[model samples]
Target: MALIETRDLRRVYDLDAGRVVALDSVSLDIDKGDFVAVMGPSGSGKSTFMNLVGCLDKPTTGHYRLADTAVERLDADGLARLRNREIGFVFQQFNLLPRVDALGNVELPMVYAGFDRRTRRERALHALGRVGLAERAHHRPMQLSGGQQQRVAIARALVNGPSLLLADEPTGALDSRTANEIMALFQELNREGVTIVLVTHDAEVGRHAHRLIRFRDGRVTEDHRQVPVDARALAREAAE
Candidate 1:
C-alpha cells in the first residue's frame, strides 16, 4: 500500500477582495519506503503541499491518506496524536534548544510522546549513534559545528521512531561540505528503509533522493526516478 496518497487536494485562502488557490487539485501517491524530493520555484505551492503532508495544515478540499488513514477526516487532537507518532520533521534551521545538550534536545520529542526517563535516554542515544553523533551527545548546540548540530537535529527527528521523515531545506543554512555530509546521512537512512520526503529548490540537494516530484502553479509538473548513487563515488566522497 502507498504510504501517502492524495486526490484532488486543494487549499484555498479567502481574502477580503479575492480567493487564492494555493494548491489546486494535486493528486499523488508516494509508495512506502520511497525517498521522494519535492521541487518548485517560490510561490509554486510546494510549501502548501508540505504543510498538508506534515499535518501542520488541513486541506481546503479533497482527500489525503497517510499510512492508510484519512488525514482530512481527523480531528485536531487526532491529527496531533498521529503527527507525534508517525512524522519526524527537520527544518532548515537546526531548531535545537540552545540551553540543552544534544541528548536532551533529542529526548524532547520522547518527552512529548510520554516516554519514561530511562527509555527516552536509551532511544535518544541510539538515534544519536545512528547519525554518528554518539560521542557528541553531551555537547550543546553552541559547542558543535554546523554539520554536528544538524546531525543532532536529525537524531532528534529519528528518536520518535516516526514512519516518515520530512525535511524542508534541511541543508539551506549549511556550507556545501556540511550539506553534503547531511545528505549522505539521509541517504544512509533511506537505505535502512526510513521513508523520506524532502522539499528543496536546489537541484543539487534534490539529487540525493531516489525520486523527484516537481510542482508548478499548485500542480504536479513532473515525476521521475534517478539512477542510484554510484557506490564507488560515494565511497570516494566518504574518504575525502
Candidate 2:
C-alpha cells in the first residue's frame, strides 16, 4: 500500500470577503521509501497540501490514508498522536529551542511520547550519530554553523523513527553549499528506506528528488518522475 494516499482533497478558508479555496480537489499517492518534491509558486497550495499531509491541518473534504489509516476520520487528539508517531517535520527555520543543546532538542519529541530518560538519551544520541552530529550533541544551536544546526534539526525529526519525513523548504535558509549538504543528507536518509515528501520552491533543490509534483492555482499541474541529481556528488565536486 502507498505510504500516503489522498483522494479528492480540498481545503477552503472563509474570509470576510468570501471563501478562498486553497486546495482544489487534489489527489496523489506517495509510496513507501519514495522521495517526492512538491513545487509551486506562492499561493499555489503547496504549503496547504503539506499542512494537511503533516496533520497540522485537516482538509475540508477528502479521503487521506497514511499507511492504511484513515486520516480524515481521526479527531484532533488522534491526529496529534498519529502525527507524533508517524510523521517527522523539518521546516525552513531550524526551530531548535534557544537554550537547549542538540541532544536536548532531539530528545524533546521522545519526551513528549513518554520515553524514559535513559531511552530518550540513547535514541537522541543515535539520531545525532546518524546525522553526523554526535560530537556536537552538547552544542547549543547558537554554537553551530547553519548547516550543523540544520543537521541537528534533522536529527530531532528522526529521533522518533517516524515513517515519513515532511520537509517544508528545509534548506531555504542555507547557502548553496550548505543547502547541497542538507539535500545530500536527505538523499542518504531516503536511500536508507525512509519515505520523504519535501515542499520546495527552488528548482535546484527539487531536482534532488525522484519525483516532482508542481502545483498551480490550487491544483496539481504536473507530476512526473525523473532521474534525481546526485546531491552528494555535487557536494563532493564543490569541495574539490
Candidate 3:
C-alpha cells in the first residue's frame, strides 16, 4: 500500500478579510521508499500539502490516508500520536535547543514518547551515528558547523524510526557545499528505505529526489518520476 494517499483534498481558511483556499482538490499517492520533492512559490499550497500529510493539519473537504489509516477519522490526540510515531520533520532552522548538546536534543523525542533513560541514550547514540555525528554528541548546537547541526537535526528526526521524513527546506540555511552534503545524506537514507517528502524552492536540491511534485495556485501542476542526480558525487566533485 502507498505510504500516503490523498483524494480531492482541500483546505480553506476563513480570515477576517475573506475565505482563502489554500489547497484545492489535490490528489496523489506516495509509495513507500519514494523520495519526492515538493516545489512551489509562496502561497502555492505546497506547505499546506506538507502539513496535511505530516498530520500537522487536516484537510477541510477531502480524504487522506497515511499507511492506510484515514487521517480525517483521527481525533486531535490520535493525529498527535500518528505524527509522533509515523512522521519525522526536519525544518530549515534545525530547531535545536541552545542549551542542550546534540545527544540531549536527539533524546527529547524519546523522552516525550516515554522511553527510559537508558533506552533513550542508546537510541540517540545510534541515531547520531547514522548521521555521522556520534563523536559530536557532546557538542552543543553552537559548537557544530551548519552542516553538522543540520545532521544532528536529521538524526533527531530519525531517532523515533518514523515511516516518513518530511523536510521543509532543510538545505536552505546552508551554503552550496553544506547543502549538497545534506542532500547526499538524504539520498543515502532514502536508499536505506526511508520514505522522504521534501519541500524546497531550490531546483538543485529538488533534482536530487527520485520524484518531483510541483504545486501552483492551490493545485498540483506536475507530478512525475525522474532519474535523480547523485548528490554524494556532486558533493565530492565540488570538493575536488
How far residue 4's Cα lies from its native spot in candidate 2, in Å, is 0.4
Candidates 2 and 3, the one with greater lDDT: 3
Per-candidate Cα RMSD to the true structure, in Å, reads 5.4, 5.9, 5.9
**Candidate structures ordered by lDDT, highest first:** 3, 2, 1
TM-score of each: 0.92, 0.94, 0.93
- Model 1 accuracy (lDDT, Cα): 0.90
Give the total clashing residue pairs for model 3: 0
Error of 2 at 182 (Å): 0.4
Please give, for residues 90-180, the per-residue lDDT of candidate 2 as tens digits.
9899999989999999999898899999999999999999999999999999999999999999999998899899999999999999999
Candidate 3 per-residue C-alpha lDDT over 1-240 given as tens digits, one digit per residue, 9 for 90 to 100: 678999999999999999999999999998777899999999999999999999999999999999879999999999988888889999999999989999999998898788999999999999999999999999999999999999999999999999899999999999999999999999999877788999999999999999999999999999978854346534443564
TM-score, model 1 to reference: 0.92
- As a whole number from 0 to 100, the lDDT of residue 196 in candidate 2 is 89
lDDT of 1 at 186: 92
- Model 1 per-residue lDDT tens digits across residues 81-171: 8788889989999999999999999999999899999999999999999999999999999999989999999899898988899999999
